[model samples]
Target: MTRMVLGAGTGLAVAGCSREASALMDDYATVSQAANEPVAGLTLDNSQLMGIREAGLQRRVSGFLSREWSDHFVTLDNGAILVDINARALHYWSEDERTYKIYPVSVPLSEDLTRTGKTSVVQKREGPDWRPTPNMLKRNPSLPAYVGPGPENPLGTHALYLGWQYYRIHGTNDTRKIGRKSSNGCIGLYNEHIAELFGMAQVGTQVLII
Candidate 1:
């Protein structure tokens, strides 16, 4: 899927509620219909790609095929789309960019919104203390220990603060929920996973929440 930023007033620019808007809507309908036209499954030699009888070759994810953000998310190699959502898990498949693959991101259900320019500060620490800030205490009102790097520290190593105090994407003493939802606004990942992401993402990587 192509990731297009819907700028403010873009709707107005595309078409208005007046005659122009109706015309624009018609054009959109046409384009949408064409794009939705069914095309046979991906194939190699005029035959289904999965039908090929080759060693170590077979389509693993065979279920619902839908359009989504993976559409238009062009691969860096040939500017082709990359699909990240599938039944298996958060997958990234880059067409044309034969060398790149997508990874899964376990975003927490933080108490914050995923907005643009919502900066993230990464702090790396092992056995980092979980000092309950005054605000955090106000929210929980019964948080224990409230301080010191310990087993219960909420601010796991490599904290990505989102200006929303007490909210972050940090490491976890619990590794079971690395790829699932189980956090309070802060994204949880395996230590090695965050470490890898930290190295790849720069200080200002755009974190889009679709």
Candidate 2:
């Protein structure tokens, strides 16, 4: 598993340990070999590395699905979002395609911070401002009371608020954090991927976080 240390303050910059850093070296090699086959003259960079990591995480999630839920990859709703916390990935069921596409995501680093079971989208927001909850403030008193939308905002550019208490499928400014367990409780995805997902999802869309 990837181990990372969360920095203090509002933005929560992620810093990995030596083990993770070493694993990332292997990740670069694996991603580069795959890229060479599909795209000529393609080299792996930090951005691409993150994408590769997401894809790798998705594969692991797929393996789990194959073993446990062979017939289903998402919620019963055609437009639902299924979150696999154990695999640190989110599967978005595309209505038009009639299939699910997995995306790398960040979940609560500690199991205690995460909640499981079914929910639905209650609200959605673009360029959402982030307000540190009381528990978050308790953990990090130095954190700002509120952060407006911008690079520093943890909620990124879009947020799909869930029916569960204080949980949402949101974007993050820190793309590197994706594929790692780092969120306070909510699900975190790359801003670009979230932008795509935000458009497909709607109010009352089912969400199952397992």
Candidate 3:
């Protein structure tokens, strides 16, 4: 996996609500196995290219499939979110079970950075600020000490902080990161998707990453 270095100097431009947003939503609604392939015309490093190829192979060999909400949780009391790392997708179920949504996501760059298990949303923020993790700083000493809420902020428009420290389900200013292995650790969604999720998800919502 290739590390997507996030630094203060990195100028991440927000796509806002555009045609790409609609396309992303459509892609999520009818995600195919081939959706895991690298985006066309998107430049990737050698490691990233290799990772995508391996991921493609793994998907073929395992016949990667989506699971039902009941497969992981007995109930969806306050709603539930399942982050499928292998599929690079996020599944959401409404508390009343009247609504279910699936969104493409960006997972951790590598397995070492990924954490899988049950956790819950502990905090929610709109226009969230960002600070690089200590390890992120150590890996890239040039990263800014802090980034305020704005288009440049990597956290995008909304963030749902999980029970696990430093782990979050958040939006990204750089839409290209979605549906790819690009995040340092957090699971990333499109800004529009996260905004919708933010409106639906409560702080106590259950989350399972697998």
Candidate 4:
């Protein structure tokens, strides 16, 4: 399967409502629809792609089918992030370049997490503090009150706060956890990957967790 790269073309130039905005929306819609379809002449059975078959995941995620970012997300045209839990990957769309770059990531282990949907980046911070939520504290009472920015900090060096309740996309001190299911309902990226993504993202950037 071809990588998820849209041809080099200009994306939304100026932010806000305009004709370009409408065209970008239409372009994304076309892209989304195409993703759901199986690519012709590609035999996925023996193909070895990044998101290829995992022992116990759904075919939609494990197969060669290109799972596009959902229609519910609105800012792919102006730059956005899509997190595919089953694939354990984050797709970063650069609005200016009109291209996407995939990064291996970690997601929540719990299957019951219901935070999947569209949301915007509410805040972004570097050298972020790690404050465990009350629920996280309940799950593990030994958690410290907070951890300041440093190598010991679980949030790593960069963090993007989500519009959803208490969720964030942040870097991790443990790089080994990337490309696995080992997070507390938040998206976890390698420190280097998060640094690059942080430079690409901004406040109000759309995030789609699928």
Candidate 5:
């Protein structure tokens, strides 16, 4: 139920009314806290969360998650979607509709760091440029490189700045690489899939990472 607004003044900023936000968070908490050792928000279980319930879904079923079918944008509260920047996954729950969807994605990271441990959607931009921060430069002395937006640019299509961190969950030129935990730290998503995610999210949203 985490609502992520799209096309806000900041462009891709997420917002939501408290009532709606509370419902989504509560549900997410239920899922994340299911095993008691919850992380931040929710880490979806392919079995219960996905279509792993039906007895007939054994042989052909792919753990309720796969490249097709469940491969869709997940909208969170206030018009935001829960983005798995590492696994390049998007998670959302249908509120009035009463259902949930998950999708594989690809996002780019800041050029400053050689790699990253994880990523988040804390900061956002319209056509953002990669301005390597001092800390980033500190990580890589030869950094502070300015990687602008465009084709051939490391930030392939979309860009979701990671708060103050020098990372982003954006689109990528690499389409073949998705649904895996691969990245210096940023989330890489397929071009079309991320577009669906970007369309579903906005600013001021809470991006909980596990």
Candidate 6:
């Protein structure tokens, strides 16, 4: 198996626009060529190397392995979404198995703030409002009670409400958080990515966070 170094700064930054996406494609193309060569330090295995190449094909920014729906779900009836917290990536598969997409994401800031298990998309909202959860307010008393839809809103352009209370898979105005551990118990995507996902996902979509 091929092995490559996992340097601290080794990661891909995905931009939210097509032009930037093209640039990332070029960058990944250059990196993929080196996948088979062994690197001298802390290394990742062949599967990870393949993921880097697979991510490039989708024209999305991702720094983790691609996932298979069969590995997490028995059926993709209403479509399925798999949020891999450790990978900081979200995998989606259409009900017909005709569409698959992966997006870089932001996960909970700490283990205590994270909740993992099965859930479903209970609601889908465009221009969604933002209100810090009660626990969020307790941690930061200065937090506002409500925020309307707009660029300033923390929820960004769209949101997919999960079956779990106070949890959601939503867009972020703060793009810097993607591919990092930076959410408050929720998963976050780029505003553009979430908007696209919002259009593709439905209320009954299955979700599995692992």
Question: How are the candidates ranked when ordered by TM-score, highest leading?
Answer: 6, 3, 4, 2, 5, 1
On residues 1-210, what C-alpha lDDT tens digit does candidate 6 reach at each position? 322333232234444324433332221111111122222223545565466556542222233345568999999999999988887778888999977777767788789989999999999999998887888778767666877887667677899999999899998765556666776888988787798889889999999999
Model 2 — TM-score against the truth?
A: 0.67
Q: List the residue pairs that clash in candidate 2.
A: none
lDDT of 5 by residue, 1-210 (tens): 323221111111112224432332222111110111111122334443333224221221222132221333244344334554444455544333343445544333333323433233565554455554565457556543676765434445677666645556666543333443334455555455456556555554434442
Q: Which tens-of-lDDT digit does each residue in 87-127 have in candidate 4? A: 77677776774555566666776786437988888899999
Candidate lDDT values, in order: 0.35, 0.62, 0.70, 0.61, 0.41, 0.70
TM-score for each predicted model, relative to the true structure: 0.42, 0.67, 0.71, 0.68, 0.47, 0.73
Provide the RMSD of all predictions against the true structure, rounded to 1 decimal: 18.4, 10.9, 11.7, 14.1, 15.7, 10.2
lDDT of 1 by residue, 2-86 (tens): 2222111111001112343233222211111001111133322323333322311133223123334344342223222121222
Task: Give the count of colliding residue pairs in each prediction.
Answer: 14, 0, 0, 0, 30, 0
Q: List ranges where model 3 is wrong by over 4 Å.
A: 1-66
Q: What is the Cα-based lDDT of residue 171 in candidate 4?
A: 80
Task: Score candidate 6 by lDDT.
Answer: 0.70
**Lowest summed lDDT window (length 10), candidate 2:** 31-40
Q: Could you give candidate 3's per-residue lDDT for residues 84-129 as a string of tens digits? A: 8887778788899877666667788788989999999999999999
How far residue 44's Cα lies from its native spot in candidate 6, in Å, is 15
Any runs in candidate 4 off by more than 4 Å, and if so which?
Answer: 1-77
Model 4 global lDDT (CA atoms, 0 to 1): 0.61
